[model samples]
Target: MQPNSVSPASEKQHIVIVGGGMTGGLLAVLLAEQGLTVTVLDGAPAPVMPTGPAQLRVSTLTEASHWLLQNSGVWEYLDMSRVQPYDAMQVWDQDGTGEVLFRAREVGAQSLGWLLENGHLAAALYRRAADYPNLHWRCGVAVEGARREEGRWQVRAGDEQWQADLLVGADGARSRVRDWAGISGGARDSGHHALVATIATALPHNACARQVFMESGPLALLPLYSDPQQGEQRQCSIVWSGWPERIARLREAAPADFAAELQAATGEALGEVTLLSERAVFPIQERHASSYVAAGLALVGDAAHVIHPLAGQGVNLGLLDAAVLAEEVERATQSGRSCADSAALARYQRRRRGENLLMQNAMRGFQQLFGQRALPVRWLRNTGMRWVNQAGPLKRLFASQAMGRGADLPVRARPRA
Candidate 1:
């Protein structure tokens, strides 16, 4: 198919976003809500409810993200029955005696955050976008190539061509749109792999999220909804980060043997862990683009940066990126200016880039600090955790930051009364 004819530059901004997953769909819906024409292209189909068991791919979304979803009309569409809220977090050092605890009530919040399948959010974002007239979703196709023509962006996908005054890359870590914009960055390898799976614990999860710093890396047992297949609610999602050699052993181990190792790793916190799903492993790495914007293009979410999963801040940060970009775009459109104008894009980068870098660095720092099995490093982290836990003000400040409320938030992401 021939490329679609390009729109005149003088016309209102027509935006085309690549990668229609969580971030792309979100940015599309938001721009459409601002009355801008948005076309989303992805090689994948829209998300729908799974037919069998709960999925292993999940994210921990903060209150700020929840607020943005609510305003975008996505949160209300989520299947709450599949959602689980954690009011508490228990983090401890495995090789040491240091441990710290956090609770939402200390921060005057009902629950800290939630754990939901990635597909659940994708489905919600897609369903919410369906109600908007300005959102033109073109799924099961990809942006073959993108180029700037006549001060606008034009992309080729198979036989079809879609042109827009502005373009965005939400295509994730290996973003083709970002490459098209000539953005490059060096990726840092954490030298670890994350193994994810669903398991039924010998004891109830008790609605608490737990993590333990082992010699290998950090292990998180995020509370998840019960399994519909089992007719019981005792399952939890676990993410264990470790070196490739160790991860391979677990991945190849027998199910029963893997369960025993997992239980031993957690110090038997939730009792024996019985694996309920096949363990999946992914290499962990940190990536950030040198710049988030080009002349007629911008990047958001994993396209711009990918952080360590230590704090589970990866998705929340991406959602914030979408919110800030939408806010900046709305500001420009209201002033009768191009939404992809240099000034507006710069504002978005300025607001989001610094925060993302901070989180990325923090995760790296913890990884390095905890990667050591030395007596001194272990002692230091444990002591620090003890102090942070014992000091009321310090603990509150950390909790607020973890909740994504310590800094100024985009109005679209602020919670409603």
Candidate 2:
């Protein structure tokens, strides 16, 4: 239902969320499912079921994230035919003999992760959210202002105004809600730009995701569904990162030249590459909010932190943020406290910020390590990778982390009984 028809204000705890993209949309559903009133303000129109060929933008959903979607009733709305489950992952260095392979069987799991277009996931979330009567969707409505008054949040969109017990900013990297709330944060460029595109490969991807680390940056070839007519598992999505000038040149190069370069980059691992979609490039930036919560207001997803996409964990981290915040809100309610209790928001921040920071720093370290040109540094990294591959416990540890299996996962993301 559109937000034009205002529901009679009730005593139910209400939440106002700005930005109804993937993360905010999920948050709205999670809160509304708990009997809380949620209103989502999104500048973009309501999402519809994505169709036709895959989009250039995509996201990798880890096992934990998958569980969150399933438990929240969003997974069923997705088109399973478009979901690509990768059973294995391979990482290697282009400059050295450092190679490591992780298979689902090693961890007793059926698949490592699922890859799907970003639009598909967002649309599925909006579809599931529609099932909740308590959820109000304000499509094509931009939040113009936000502030605190009388222990509640006052949000304004054009001439419309809303008050809520809690206010959340899930509006992505350049969150206006965050700015209005006076949350402090900074973004640092990673000195690299990622060029993303969909491609058709001569050889089947074999349900495997692969990445090759070069001095410039890392290039990942993630598996996707095969072409229906051809019925060959050759469809893949590529994220190639490098210096701004280098990425610019690659983005403008002829399709054949680009495909040739892609083939060379992967050492023909997937055989000759054929560009099937237009390429898009985006600068890499690392951002973190100095504090995730202030009073009844909180930030989640990219509004709170944004890390490198090297491991495809950006979306996973955002999903975890939504889950943890929901859990904390539920915990506060059960304990006879307000859903926007400061302690609850603090707990959510405490649980998420450290982990997100760790991953961000880790990615920075990996980039710097691989970017090194010294011979000793190169040998050390290559030998370390080989040793880790040979070490069963270490390999399993890495695999488990990549699959989002950790002790501190929010209750919603945990495996079902």
User: Per-model C-alpha lDDT, please?
Assistant: 0.86, 0.90
lDDT of 2 at 320: 93
For model 1, give the RMSD to the true fold.
3.2
Q: Given candidate 2, what's the lDDT at residue 246?
A: 92
Compared with the true structure, what per-residue lDDT tens digits does model 1 show for residues 58-144? 999898888888888889989888998889989898888788899999988988898999999988887777787667777687668
Best by lDDT: 2
Q: Which pairs clash inside model 1?
A: 1-159
What C-alpha lDDT, on a 0 to 100 scale, does residue 74 get in candidate 1? 88
User: How accurate locally is residue 262 in candidate 1, as Cα lDDT from 0 to 100?
Assistant: 88
In angstroms, the error of model 2 at 151 is 1.4
Q: Which candidate has the top score in TM-score? A: 2
Candidate 1: regions farther than 4 A off: 1-13, 228-233
Show model 2 residue runs off by greater than 4 Å: 1-13
